[model samples]
Target: MIIEQSHFLFVSLYIFAISIGGLLLNRRNIIILLISIELMLLAINLQFVIFSVFLDDIIGQINALLILTVAAAESAIGLALLVVYYRIKGTISINKINLLHG
Candidate 1:
């Protein structure tokens, strides 16, 4: 049990670290943004699994599946938005976007 629990903790922490790193590295590159989003999703999934294992409950697994579906939808929407932005501005820099009109 100790080994299994430790493994779960290690995996969860690793995923969290990757997600943080990805977000920190976000830049004008749309690909990096997408990757960061993916890493964040992966981290959530890892936590769900770890908790599910710790509690010996199926709900965690179910929640993890739901999270994956949501993540996919989010990525699709985000990519679509990025495409629209790029088409309009000819660049994907988040810093340059200021479409809000006062």
Candidate 2:
């Protein structure tokens, strides 16, 4: 019971940190956005592993692997977008690239 509670607390704190980081740093830095996304993904992965271990099931591990693949793809796309935006705007600052009115 104690272990489960601790896991819940840890996951909650990680999610809260990710949310706060995303909200506060979205306009200030693109890297922070990436980090925040990774943090959120990590929390999900942790939860999956915990549940898998608790249930003695392998499905959670498989799901976590899938999530990791999705995260990699997401990061690749995000970085690609950032690169394109930087090429056009000459900066990677998220606040300065608001020219998406196409």
Candidate 3:
């Protein structure tokens, strides 16, 4: 039995679509936005690895590693900001973000 590259491609595309939908549709919480972004990155990484394996090329894998590193850093920074915002505002909801207008 063998799995085709298009199968993995379609799976990754589906994941990307869900993540985008989550980001666009869920606007009440900041945490969910960050999570959706992470999921999108994961989908991208999955696509990179799938293509890399299918093409027998290392460049795609390397790109995936770089993206993984960026995702980790982004998550860390995002969490730290969330913590700070929560401490000051005592809530992680995006509705209160209008306070930044000052």
Candidate 4:
């Protein structure tokens, strides 16, 4: 089985579409929104790796690693904020977040 550039592009597009749908339609759930953001990041990372492989370039891999690190940090900070919000508000609903006056 030989994988081509088109295959990578198709898969990346599919992931991006699903992630956007998740972000737009699941606005009430903060966790789903966070997961969707991660999915989008993964899709970008996939494209980076695919292009790097096809072009024999190391910069793409380095860029992907940087993105991965940023994604990890983002997720960690987001989850920590979510936990604090849940502890203070007792709910994880995005709609209810605005009740915090500060």
Worst 10 residues of 1 by lDDT: 1-10
C-alpha local distance difference test of each model = 0.82, 0.81, 0.93, 0.94
| Most lDDT-accurate candidate | 4
Candidate numbers sorted by lDDT from highest down:
4, 3, 1, 2
| lDDT score, candidate 3, position 81 | 89
Instruction: Write one digit per residue (lDDT tens) for candidate 2, span 1-102.
Output: 346746675875778687677967577788787878787887888788777888899998999999999999999999999898889889988567678758
Off by over 4 Å in 1: 1-3, 100-102
**Would you estimate the TM-scores of all the predictions?**
0.81, 0.78, 0.94, 0.93
Candidate 1 residue-wise lDDT, 1-102, digit = tens? 347777877887887788788778766776787877788788778888888888989998999999899989988898898888889989877678788546
TM-score of 4: 0.93
Lowest lDDT sum, 10 consecutive residues, model 4, at: 93-102
Which segments of candidate 3 are over 4 A away from where they belong? Answer: none
Question: lDDT for model 3, on a 0 to 1 scale?
Answer: 0.93
The TM-score measured for candidate 2 stands at 0.78
Backbone clashes counted, model 2: 0
Q: Write the per-residue lDDT of candidate 4 for residues 15-99, one digit (tens) a residue.
A: 9999999998887998999999999999999999999999999898999999999999999999999999899989998777787
Q: What's the true lDDT of residue 70 in model 3?
A: 95
Put down candidate 3 lDDT per residue, 1-102, tens digits, no spaces. 788998999999999999999999999988889999999999999999998998999999999999999999999999998899889989888887877787
